[model samples]
Target: MQAKEIREVSCVGAGVIGYSWALYFAMKDLSVTVYDINEESLQLAKKRIHESLETLIKNNVLTKEKSEELEKSIIYTLSMEEAVRNAQLIVESGPENYDIKRQMVEEMEKYTSIETIIVSSTSGLLITEICKNAKHPERFIGAHPYNPPHLIPLVEITKGDKTSEVVVEVAKEFYTLIGKEPIVLKKEALGFICNRIQMALYREVCDLVTRGVCTIEDADKAVTYGPGLRWGIMGPSLVFQLGGGQYGIAGALKHMGPSANMWLADMADFKKIPDEFAMIAQEGVNEELKNRSAEIGNDNASLAEYRDKMLIELLKLHHKL
Candidate 1:
């Protein structure tokens, strides 16, 4: 199906990701139906949907009136049939477990046509495995959105072994139409794109803290005040192109490679997280939180508010909000 033909969206599993997807689709003026297992879950999803839009409203991304109007576009349901009835796009934000996801598609296929595009919100599970038993695997693909989908623009799209190229293109176009930045993987990779890069950096942070090279607070400050700042505006390669001055990325690499290679050689190489660092990182974050002002948030809820506010301002600069 064409992107323009995807006028109705079905969000299965009404957790944070699912509801946020519903909110974004609805905000873009698409009709969205959210399905969950029970009233309590759907109710929680509704509350979260409201609160997320309120964040957008507070950041001037949406007026209160407009947000209310957008809320009208979303409907919550417990019935799977009701959810997928008229949906051209089914965004399954269920569990990350392969078996559960596999089962979800089995039930979903009973209700949806082969023409309906099914996109799993699995973080790292291969879509090929997830859809192997499906009646219509060709329409299935993986679309992983960064947290708080209404605010974040990154959605990594991965194709299943049998997934149609047309399905991939239609999904990409639909996400772009709703103002999301979608990247498609040519070949399946563990953790997709952003997660690998994020985890790689995080591994170094953990390594530095464990080795007593720096405190968690200092590492965070370094990133927030350093490359993270430039990265928000432009990607690292583009930033390095400017950093190279008279030269480009190739020049920057030439001048910076020796020391970078040294640092890389010394960086973390472990596959799993170091066990002791969990408490170490938490303690450091708690200590870091103590230093923050109330206006910038000293706790989880307030910090989220602070993050969404800043994110909206940044989105505005990019002409996205």
Candidate 2:
């Protein structure tokens, strides 16, 4: 069935991701049932969700009227059977433990229809390995979203080994219908797309400090102010393509190839170094956050409001933002 026809969705686990998923689905006008085993945690999840919606409204990102409607559309439950019984799409976000997921899937399979689409929000675990014995493997897919789901727009939609092309297509359409920038994974690989790239950069940052080339603060500033702005617009490859007549690696090969290769080799050899760099990186991050935590929290509300206002201007400027 098409995603537009899906009217109800069930979210398993009432943790951070679960609450975010509930708000996202409810905002789309879909009835959502959020289930969890812990009664107290579930109450906290409900309270957090309402407060988040209020924050969005205060920021002018979500309307108060719409927020009320979304609250009404959501229902909290502790019964797994009740949550999945009528849901057309089930998103599992339970603990990362493999045994826990296996048990949850085992129970859900008995209740959900064969046609229901089951998506896991796991970051790196192999879905094929986890759901190897699931009843309907074709309907199982990975719908991983980044942290703070309300702010991040990217969603990685990956299909397991036995997942059909139709399942991938439907998942993409489902996410897009809710205004997510979902990308379909051609096939499963370790860390998928974003995380792998993230790790690569992280490795280099570690190496830089290990070799005494720069302090952790310097590396952080380089990425946050330098490549990060361009990355916000496009990937490294596309960014280079627009850089004067040079196109990606070809241009870099002619201009900065020697330096790039040197760094690559340094990174390879630097991995065997001592733990000083790791300590520095960790301390640097902690110190920076410690200095800014209060300021960040103080302005988070107003910043979110400004963000929404700018979004309206952005859409007008681009005519499609």
Candidate 3:
């Protein structure tokens, strides 16, 4: 069945990611049943959803009345059977452990219809490994959303070895219909796309600070005030294409390839965070947020609000909203 025909979606696990998925589906006018074993977590999920909906309304993404209506569309339940009974799509955001995910998939298979499309919100785990014990692995896929899934537009839809092309397409269409920018991966790889690129940049950032080349604050400013500004407008590849002048990417590479190769060779190759660097990183982040936390109260929440607000405006400018 086509994604547009799917009216009910079940979100397993009421953690932040699952709750955000529930909220997004509800906001798009789909019936969402969120299942979690913990009542307290469910309550917290409800609270966050309410708070995020208010933020969305404030940002003009939704009317107050519409937000209220959407809030009602989400149903919280502790029973997995009840959650998946009528669901056409199941989004599982349980623990990231392979064994836990494997067990969850196996249990969910017992409750869901054979046609139900199951997807995981795993960051780095392979979908094939997660669905190894599934009765029907072809119905399973990976639908990794960035943190705050409701706000982030990108959802990476990846396939397992046994995941059918039709299921992948349907998953992509489903996410797209719910107002996400869904990119399908040809094959499963660790960290998918964004996270891999994100970690690569993070590694270099840590390397710079660890080497005393610059403070964390300076590194942040360098990105935010420099390439980051253009990055928000276009990806690095396209930016380089523009840098190529009339010759585009090829010309830009020809001019800068030697210097780029030299820098690449000198990049850090550490697989884990060094102990000394970890201390420096922690201290730097704390120092950066100290004043901002005092001013805004609840540093994380305030920063998230600020992020969502800016994202709404940026998405609007990009015609993504």
Candidate 4:
């Protein structure tokens, strides 16, 4: 079915991610059914969903009345059959284990029609293996969202070998319909796209700290005040294109390539992170938080609130909310 034809969607598993997806779908004016096994989880989802709507309201994402109206639009269910029977698309955000995911897929297949498109929210698992035993494998796809999918706009769509091209397109368009930025993966990747880029940069930070080049807090400051600001507006390549002046990116690379290569040579190459780094990183984060002002948040709870508020403002600048 076409993207526009998708009116009813099911979110299988009412954990944080699943409930967030349900909230997003409802906000987009789609009929959403959230399914889970336990009643407590569903109740918790209801509470979180209400709080999330409040966050959106505070961010000016919607008016209070509109939030209330759509808040009641979501239908929560315990039976998988009741959830998927009428859904044109299903987003399974079940446990990230092979056994758990495979079991969910088998159960979802039983209730969902063969023509219904089902997508996994698996971050690192290969879509090929996840749907390998599916009765309707062609209809399965991977649509990994950034954390708190309702707030974040990016969704990475990947297709398994058995997935249909049409399914991929529909998934992309469906995410677009909900005001999200959706990117299709040309080939399967372990960390997909953003995660790999994030980890690569993070690895360099770890290396710099371990070598005494900079402290963890200083590294955070560098990213926050430097390239991170620009990255929010434009990608790195485009920023470099500007840095190249009239010469463009080619010239920038040509001039910087030698130094970049030397740095890359000195960068961390270990497949596994140094185990001692975790404790050190935690200590660094504690110090960093302690150094911050009350306005910016000096603790975890307040810091998260600051982050959400800041993210809303950024998303506003980009016209996402």
Worst 10 residues of 4 by lDDT: 300-309
Across 71-189, the per-residue lDDT of candidate 4 in tens digits comes to 88999999999999999999999989989999999999998788899999999999899999998789999999998898889999999999999999988998888799999999999
Misplaced by over 4 Å in model 1 are none
> Tens-digit lDDT track for model 2 on 110-220?
999998999999887888876887988889888899865655668998887898788888889888887778998888887889988887788777877767788776887
Count of backbone clashes, every candidate in sequence: 0, 0, 0, 0
Clashing pairs in 2: none
Model 4: residue 233 alpha-carbon error in angstroms? 0.9
Q: Which prediction has more favorable TM-score, 3 or 4?
A: 4
Query: What are the per-residue Cα lDDT tens digits for candidate 3 across 227-273?
Result: 99999999998999999999999999999999999998999988986
Question: What TM-score, to 2 decimals, does candidate 3 have?
Answer: 0.95
Clashes of 2: 0
Report the alpha-carbon TM-score of model 2 versus the true structure.
Answer: 0.86
Candidate 2 lDDT: 0.79
TM-score of each: 0.98, 0.86, 0.95, 0.98
